[model samples]
Target: MMRATTAAAILLLATVAKAEDSLIEIVTREVKGCMDSEHLGSIGGLRSYNDPNSAEQKCFLGCMLKKFKALDADGQYSAEGLKTTIQHCPRMKSHPDIQKAALQVADECNGKVTGCSDYCSCAPLAAKCLHEGMKNKSFQTIFIALDEALDKMQS
Candidate 1:
């Protein structure tokens, strides 16, 4: 019985490690696609996130979405996809789409998103913007609070 339990534990560990690795790969690929399609090597607009004024963060996200939509018309936020993603990510919260994409991964594969899917709205191209946006703490702070407010309103 001890040996069986040990083997099962090892198997679970291996599975978890593999899942993490797969999620990383998926994120990397998606981000790369976003960067390539959008021609956005780096965003100069996101530098003010630490300045205490959270407005820039919101503006940056909005601008990024427009640019992304222009680059990949197929990736446009459908009314349904936007609603679902918003429901999952709650837009008032900073990077709602980014949060949605991340949560989409969590939802689709037990916290491991290996590829884009119906739930995960961030396509190969849009994921890059999300990854970049998340690095700004100011944005996160405002976004999180906003998410709480929005969630409450919705509820």
Candidate 2:
């Protein structure tokens, strides 16, 4: 009985470790794509969450959201889909604030997104809209919060 329990525990630990690694890989790739794109990268870069704000930053954020598939083909709210995509992420899965923010991002951003090009323009209108959406207490903050939570959990 003891041996069986020990084996099960080890198996569970391994699965969790793999899931964490997978989350890191997925986020790294998505962020890299957003930062590396000719259009997005030109606007400074996506290398850090902290930097001087510019019209370009708003546009790049929109681009990253799209790349992450947080929006639909018609650029509509798809929070559920987005949630599903990161369901396995340990930090997000365990945090209620993160979950609420994840779902709200679509609500906050959808109405203003006329199209991908709208973000590209970085027009005052578009930037204002995205800023409003970001202020709603959610998705824009997820990456940093989730990263911190994960690190805390590990340590």
Candidate 3:
């Protein structure tokens, strides 16, 4: 009876892990498709907020934000959508402070970029504003969490 219960628990855990893996895979595929469509190379270019100032990089960031529903059709930022995207990652959801920081950044960026004519122009400004608005420690913490999540996924 104990052996059967142990097996069941293990199986349940595996199923949950698989579901999480699938979610990540789906998001990755969608983001990759966005990159391909935008003719963007090396997502690494977006590691720094200032680095995405180029036209192509700006378009790529716009593509990603749109794909995640963080930027609406009218070139406006959605704080709720951005927060939802961050919370979608289990590791990110574990850090409530990160979510709050993200929302604050989104709100500030939204104010800066709301009047832009298109996402390409809006996204870069938003990125720059977000970078400026976020606390250094919060920014580092978010980046570290992202890096750790990526490492775990890769491994």
lDDT of 2 at 98: 50
Error of 1 at 108 (Å): 24
Which candidate number maximizes lDDT? Answer: 3
Question: How far does residue 142 in candidate 3 sit from its true spot (Å)?
Answer: 5.6
Residue 23's lDDT within candidate 2 is 44
- TM-score rank order: 3, 2, 1
The TM-scores of all predictions, comma-separated, are: 0.25, 0.45, 0.63
Q: What shift in Å separates residue 32 of candidate 2 from its native position after superposition?
A: 3.1
The lDDT of each candidate is: 0.31, 0.42, 0.53
lDDT of 3 by residue, 1-155 (tens): 01111111111011124554644454456456766888876566354244474677778767755755567886576666665565564544455555566566666656566667787877766655655665442344222222232344455
Candidate 2 — which pairs collide? none
TM accuracy, model 1: 0.25
* Candidate 2 least-lDDT 10 residues: 4-13
lDDT of 1: 0.31
Screening candidate 1 with a backbone cut-off below 3 angstroms (N, C-alpha, C), the clashing residue pairs are 34-125, 93-143, 94-143
Candidates ranked by lDDT: 3, 2, 1
What candidate 2 gets wrong by more than 4 Å, as runs, is 1-25, 35-63, 73-80, 86-89, 115-140, 145-155
Candidate 1 per-residue lDDT, tens place, 41-113, comes to 5433332122212433333333333332311244343334332333432222354444444344323322232
